[model samples]
Target: MTAPSPARVVAARVLERVVSEGAYADLALDGELDRRGLSARDVALATELVYGTLRWQRYLDWILAPHSRRRLDDLDLGPLVLLRMTAYQIAFLERVPAFAAVNDAVTLAGRARKPGVAGFVNAVLRSFSRRGATEREPRPPADLVEALALRCSFPTWLAARWMARYGASEAEALMRALNERPPLALRANTLRVTRDALAARLATEDDIATLPSRYAAEGLVANHGGSPSAWRAFADGAFAIQDEASMLVAQLLDVRPGDTVGDVCAAPGTKTTHLAQLLDNRGRILAFDPQPARLNLVREAAKRLGVTIVETLDGPAEALAPKFPALCDAVLVDAPCSSLGVLRRNPEVKWRRTLEDIVTNAERQHAIVTAAALMVKPGGRLVYATCSLEPEENEDVARRFLGAHPDFALDPPSEFPVALDADGFLRCRPHQHGTDGFTACRLVRCRR
Candidate 1:
């Protein structure tokens, strides 16, 4: 058996790791990056090849289907992945000459598998290459891939659902925004240091550029030159990596010193620690997550931020709701939803998730919101938020909850970035904010 070329070897191993070990794309890329010891250019090529292929996988398969004599799925994962990479290079990347890209892939496949398999790959690629864009039929007025690429890059079902709720133009805009990469935003821990002070300290480090967040008071967007975590500020806990949109949720909560708060669905606690900063570490925070492993992460995050007020609990919000009985001055129910927003950060979500997830997540979100609502003291505030643009998870849930619990009324978010409807909930779409696809509703409990 012949050994694989460096490119083939890397792609083969990465595909194997992701499929067999269920590893994440970034982790797999990092692991391969270290093992291959690739130069900056090589690393860039590998990264683009891997990530772009994964992002447009469905469309790639659609294009590759006619090229293969056998079924596309019947092909081994390695060659199939390589074909997708080749297709992406041809269609999207102008710098990479199409012939070179296809040839490299064919050579890699041949060496990695067998000469016969190499011929198969080369034949299919050459055949597709000659026919060019002509082989691909004119995109219909509603080609799924074109619709997705232009309108939302979301699965057809998800896009249609968004169109129903947000109308055709907004839905298309929302989906297009999801396909674009999000800017790296971080929230400064005001309890530890000022944003300007942290930014000054970070400026000394080479390859890091800093800017203030347009929306959040203590937010900063960092330009990481190839290394995101290498910034000195990250290690000192002066800042926490969070979206500018997310930081607003904590801001709108308007936590004051000595105010008791409950953060349900708080894990990997971005908002939990942000609440701590707002309260000057003066109030008790009950941070609960359904999964214990995630709760452990919340504890670690709190400790890093030098926060002592947070107490972690592992249980359902419904079960714990009655125990807290109107104890919280503020409650943040950052309910889980179909994360149609922020797909740029996690491209796997585009393929892995389905329209069915919206219903399932909406049910879970409603339960959590209802349970968390119980903890809000009379005259206290409750903020229900999700990193989703879907109305079922945002407006539908908020409307239903307000109807069922007439004691709570929607309170307009003073600090939120997006426009609030007459109902007084903040609605954020990626196209509008250039931030994560987020929606948050702030409610205040009326005194009996």
Candidate 2:
């Protein structure tokens, strides 16, 4: 029996973590890659395998279901994931030959399971390989939403909701856009380097090609390189890897130097550090999140970027709101959301999320925003934001906040109105903005 490719082995192992253990794909893949020490070529292959399999999981299952004797979901996790991994390569990854993919899957299955399991995998794949693309491909359902869901590998319920909200054509465009890889967006740590200077260094020194983001002054989109963390500029805190839309969210706070800011629900402190940068590292930033481990990421980023203004807080925003009532010049509630807006970055989310998760997060978002509202000084801006395309968590949450507290009103004047929807709430869609599907509404507390 031929040996399986180590890259395939690693990809399958990480896929198991993501599927069975609920590990984050990006973090898990990074950890495995560092431990395995795969070459750049195989590393890229493994990375592609991990993400692409997750991205097209629904569609790959559709392809495999008819070929399998047992239900795909009922199958053992190991064989189930290996089958999806192999099927993804055979169908979508053109560079990998079908025979090589099938052989590797068979080898992997044999190593993990009884003899019958290996035979089962080989028979299923050989039959799958012979059937070819068009033969195995299902006819698009008569319902446009169903067709879109199956075609784009989305949950039917999610596709249905999106189609109803965005209409069929635009929803399909959004799905297609999210299925592809997003650009590597980096925020130039203006505390240290100007955007232009950093771009020049990335090219001249690091040999990484780059382009300035059209939306954010401080944002640079790196084309291709090894991870940004490996770059000397990143090590020196010259830039922070943040989405262009997320960069815009922090900028919306418009906090000036020496002003106090509150980052309610802040963790993994990407925006916390951005607020500090915008504040010229002179003002105080009260950052809060429930988990210490996630807060550690914020602290590490702050230290790396030379940001000294951030002050981390413990407990939920509502519990801590009493400590600083009307204390900040600006407050940012980067609310915990379903993260439907960032599917390209976290493709596993499409599988993991349920409709109830959407509803529960929306309710939690409203409570957090209301609590954060109390901490904003009168006339100060309370920026409510989420990486969620869902209205219940986005506009509805903002609107509900306004209903209970008439003292707070929506503020429409923004640096990036192009991302604003017809109703004036900021809506960044992957198809339209080439960024995550972020929705932000800026609310200003009345002076009286």
Candidate 3:
């Protein structure tokens, strides 16, 4: 097999930034992919190496722990990163030769660290490469964290929380799915083109195929063919890269053409743009985010998709009620949470979030949804959603809001593909949805 290239080296550097400096993978990879001028294949390889390594880090540590003389945490972070990268390729990526993976890891380590560290990395990776090498047995279920640490490739506390919330089987399934590479999903800009038309354009590449979206008429499941951003249609902004579960949120809003809508916490405008597509660029959408930078992103996206109906506002979601009380036909509060569901895409979030963070975020979500509900006129719809699977931020917040606001009650709608309760709340998990770990619920304000 061919040896590792300069692109891999650049990927290692970016991965090191993610592991050490806590940089975002998407942002960091974008910079390096452009700086190194990597080909499409090389870009895909780098992304797989970096994201796969980060996703399965705990498992990598477990595999290497037997060979290390020092504590795994005490090992030099740079060389340890190389070990993790090598482990991911060896365990998961069958296309790459084992020797190449091990050698490249050692080479990358030598370039990044001292000779001693490189030697250590080489020895450990080669040691793991030997078949039938001794490893710690699969951890016992009695110790939930330890079991999950070994089984699911996640930090102990995170695994424990999931194990508690969703039993051992479901938690393991979710974690395994999250650790896998996410499929590319896109929402077609119906205002410009239909899903069938977009798929026909994408058909130029023999490897590309799309399925009808589970939720919306405009949604398409773009199978893994090549770099999605490099696709011609994407360049023209005919569609936007989004998760299947995320696309469902906009569909849940059930918005119509020429209706007034408000997207609270709408930065980078993933759902906001989808709402515009649903409205056919005829309705008013008041998009709000506290950060100017993200609002700029929303504006940029809107421009690319040819959406002119959205109006951007700079303020917290809670503050929007005062300016737009009883004005919107629908309100979408995509509140922030621990982001455990999308940890596969952003692995750093696993280590960054704590249980307290969940509670605090739930508090903020409740506030946002409560106030966001005020913006919806009586008998209008409001959708409260989050990427987080944690009930604290989903059902708990929704329940709290309903209890406080007697004017609002659960609304039943039968349009969803998944099973929703009588209250019309849809909760999807990676285990169930074949998508990210997300939970969304739709509510309606009762007529006064």
- Highest TM-score among the candidates is held by which one? 2
* The best candidate in terms of lDDT: 2
> What are the Cα lDDT values of the candidates?
0.78, 0.89, 0.82
| Model 2 agreement with the true structure over 1-448: per-residue lDDT tens digits | 7778889999999999997899999999999999998887788889899999999998988888888899998999999998999999989888899999999999989888586888889888988888867788767788887788998999999999989988999989999988989899999999999999999999988899999997988999997677778899999999999998999898888889999999987889899999999998998999999887888888888999999989998779989887999999999999999998999999999998999998999899988998998899998998899998898888888888899999999887754635576787887889988998888878899998
Question: Taking the tens digit of each residue's C-alpha lDDT, what string does model 1 give over 1-448?
Answer: 3433465457556755665677777788888888788666666677667666666666777777778898988888777877777877786687977778777777687667565788888888886776666565335446643565432335667666777767877777776676665687878888889999877877776556789988888888887455455566677788898998888788778789999999988898999999999999998999998899999989988988899999999988998887898999999998877776767666667777777788788888888999999999999999999988777788898888899999999888653455676767776667887788778878999999
Which of the two, 2 or 3, has more lDDT?
2
What RMSD does model 3 have?
Answer: 2.2
lDDT of 3: 0.82
Question: Using Cα atoms with residue i matched to residue i, what is each candidate's TM-score against the true structure?
Answer: 0.87, 0.97, 0.94
Assess candidate 3 and give its TM-score to the true structure. 0.94
After superposition, which runs of candidate 1 have C-alpha atoms over 4 Å from their true positions? Answer: 1-24, 27-47, 71-74, 97-100, 111-115, 126-153
List clashing residue pairs in candidate 1: 148-153, 152-175
Q: Could you report the Cα RMSD, in angstroms, for every candidate shown?
A: 3.2, 1.5, 2.2
Model 1: worst 10 consecutive residues (lDDT sum): 144-153
